[model samples]
Target: MQILIAGASGFLGRRLVSHLRDAGHDVTPLVRRPPRPGEVRWDPTSGVLDATVVAAADAVINLAGAGVADKRWTSQYKQVLLDSRVDTTRTIARAIAAAPDKPRVLLNSSAVGYYGDTGDHAVDETAPAGEGFLADVCKVWEAATGPAEDAGTRVVLLRTGFPLDKDGGLLKPLYLQFRLFAGGPMGSGRQYLPWISLPDWLDAVGFLLERDVSGPVNLTGPEPVTNAEFSAALGRVLHRPSLLPVPGFALRAAVGEFGGEALASQRVLPGVLVREGFTFAHQTVEEALQQAVSSITQ
Candidate 1:
């Protein structure tokens, strides 16, 4: 299949591009700069995208969004987060709508933060949108794909969780902290942390690309563990002691409003993926951490 992906330079995106290419799919990346070979130039900020480019792809995936945890939640950066996602999604969706021959599907990125702090309650794709800044951002972010959906495209809102790998995502820094003996749960350590192994995350994306599914799909593991459980799993995998814990107030002081959210509980479940018969390579956090740690050592 011919796939065109925005945000192809990002950590997950870079891996996805390679994964798809290795699987014999022709993947073209949408770049901000001038077009290179096998690349399409698009500027979401300027709303510049060729409809022909959109029409030619068999599928389109838009993972373009500002990192929610990259900066403190100041009003300015908050707007930046909102605009970065909404604008890019709107541009891609509009392009797809304008195309004479539309792509079969659009897998747009979202986050499990859509459910806000779920406490211990589990949530699937059918859950209502929750409150808080990250939740609000995810709401608008997913809604930005309206144009393409209105144009009859099969839109899949990827409500992703923490994709754990040794190189990037949530595990990298945590790995370092563990090695230094500073790693432990944040806040009360009771908040649930929804996670998926990196390999599983990549494979799930491929599964969604071909599956006859639409709407919000939780790209998370089958069994979600609490932050404390996550810390224990990582510690066990690394032969480190998981004793020190970061207090909630200290987290809030360090990263502003996002700090509270860092410890938010989201026991998200992959309802669609499971019902569709997608299998996970790592069913538990410990197994996931083992793979991630092994990758780092090698």
Candidate 2:
């Protein structure tokens, strides 16, 4: 299969590209820069994508978006978050719609934050969306793919959870603090972290690429751990004691509304993926942490 991936240089995108290539699929990276040895340039920002580039793809995975937790959610940053997602998705959808031979699948990205603070309730793909900034962003983010879906493309919205990669993402900040022996649970430590190992995340994408699955699929580990549990698990894996607990006020002062969302309870599960026969490489938090830490150290 010929696969075209947008944002191919990003954290998940890079992994997805490697996964697709390793699986014997011809992978093409769509970027803003000129086409390199194996990459194809497509400016989603200015809506200047070459139709022939995407029209030739058997599948197109859209992962182009600004990081939600990259910056504090000021009004300016909020707009960045919204536009980066909605606009890029819109651009891709339009390109796919205009393509002569549309891709069979369009796996667009979303987040488990779609369920907003679900407390202890385990949310599946069928769960109704919750309220707040991240949720609102995800709602529009998923909706922006309608053009391609309407054009007969099988659009799948991957409502991703926290991807547990030791080299990057959420682990970066924690790893530093843990190495300094100042890492522990954030806020009340009760907020559930619905996280996925990078391997399982890539595997889930491959599974969807090969299957007829569409709509929202939660790309999360089967086991959802609390912030406290996550802290302790990482600490255990790193052979360190997680003792420094961050207070809610301090987090709010640092990250504002987004910080509150992070600290809020969200016990999301990968119900749909499991029920659909998708097996996980790391089912337990400890196992996932071990793999992530091993990758980081080695």
Candidate 3:
């Protein structure tokens, strides 16, 4: 398959490129800088893009977006988050629609944040959008794909969860604290965390590319754990003690609005993936953490 991926330099996108290439697929990355040999260059914010290349792709995955947790949620950063996601998606979708030969599948990225604080409740794709700033952003984010969807492209919204990796993910920060002997649960540790290992995330996206699936798919693991449980599992896997705890107030003070999400309880289940018979390479938190540590340290 000839796959075109936007945001290919990001944490997940780079991995996807390698995964597909190793499997004998043609993967062309749409970068933001000057064209580098095989890569396609375009800045979505500036309305620059290669429409013909977009149209010719067998499959297109737009993972382009600013990281929600990258910075403190000042008002300025909030707008940046919105523009990065909505504008980038709009640019890619428009190009796909304008293409003479449209891609068969469009895999757009979304997040479990769409569900907002679900508390201990199990959320599936059938669940309605939850409340909060991130939820609002997600609603607009997925809605930006209407152009491609209306153009008869098979649009799949990957409503993914926290992707576990040792060197470059949500785990790295916690790992640092752990190394300093301050590793423990954040907030009350009761909030449910929906997560998936990097391997499963990549494989699941590839599976969706081949299957006849569309609409929102929850790309999370079958098992969801509370913050405390996740902390324990991660500690066990890293062979470190999990004893310290970050208070809810401290978390909120540290990251502002995003801290609300960090402490928010969302137990999203991979309902679509399961019903579609997609096999997961990793299931439990401990399993994912162990795999991540071994793979990265190697």
Candidate 4:
């Protein structure tokens, strides 16, 4: 299988590329800068991608987008978040549609944020979308992949959860606080955090690529932990005591509207993937935290 991956330099993207390559798949990364050894340059912002790159690929996994939680959600940054996802997806969809030999599968990236604050509700692919800025962005983002689907390609939208890795994503900030012995629960500490370990996330992506699955599939761990449980698990794995608690008001004041989403409850499960017999490499929060923290320290 020849796979072309956008955002191949990002945290998850880098890992995904390596995983695909290790599986004996011919991997070509779509980078923004000059072509590195195995990378191919394609500027999604300007909609300038190499035709040769898209034409020769069996699948195109679109992960190109600005970081949603990278900055404080100022009004401008909010627009940047929405436009980055929608525009990049649209660009890739158009390019895929125009390609002579279109890729068989279009694995577009999405988030669990599409379900918004589902308090204790088990959301499957059949669940209707929730409402919010991120939800709206995801709705449009997924819809943007229509071009590829219309072009007779199977489109798989991965509604990813909080990918657990010590070096990046949500874990980085938590690790800093934990190193200082100040890491604890956030807000009420009751919000259900649907999370996935990096290895499991990569495996899920590979499973989707190899299978005949399409539409929105929740790429998350089967065991959903609350914010407090997650913090305690991380603290236990690091052999550190979690003492500090971040108040809801502080987060709200610091991040504005976006903070609410972070604090809200969402107990999501990967029903579709599990039903389809996808086995998780790391099933529990404790096992995931141990591996993630150990990897960083080593």
Winner by lDDT: 1
Whichever of 1 and 3 has more lDDT, that candidate is 1
Clashing residue pairs, backbone N/CA/C < 3 A, model 3 = none
Q: Which residue pairs in candidate 1 collide?
A: none
- Mind giving the per-residue lDDT tens digits that candidate 3 earns over 113-232? 899899888989999999999899999999999999999999999998988887676887887787677899988899899989988999999899999999999988889999899999
Q: What tens-digit string does per-residue lDDT give for candidate 4 at 1-298? A: 9998888878899888889989999988887777779788877778877666787999999887889878888889989998888888888888888899899999999999899889877777788889888888899999999988999989999999989998789998999899889999999898899999989999999999989999999988999999999999999988898768899999989988878988977788998899899999898999988888886778
Best by TM-score: 1
What C-alpha lDDT does candidate 2 achieve relative to the native structure? 0.89
After superposition, candidate 1 runs with Cα above 4 Å error: none
| Model 1: per-residue Cα lDDT at residue 146 | 94
Candidate 4 lands at a TM-score of 0.96
Better of 1 and 2 by lDDT: 1
RMSD of 4: 1.4
Q: Which ten residues in a row have the lowest lDDT in candidate 2?
A: 42-51
- In angstroms, the error of model 4 at 235 is 1.6
- TM-score against native, each model: 0.99, 0.97, 0.97, 0.96
Q: Per-residue lDDT for 1-298 in model 1, tens only?
A: 9999998999899999999999999999999998899898889998888999899999999999888888899999999999999999999999999999999999999999999989999999999999999899999989989999999999999999999988888998899999999999999999999999989999999999999999999999999999999999999999899999999999999999999889899999999999999999999999988988895767
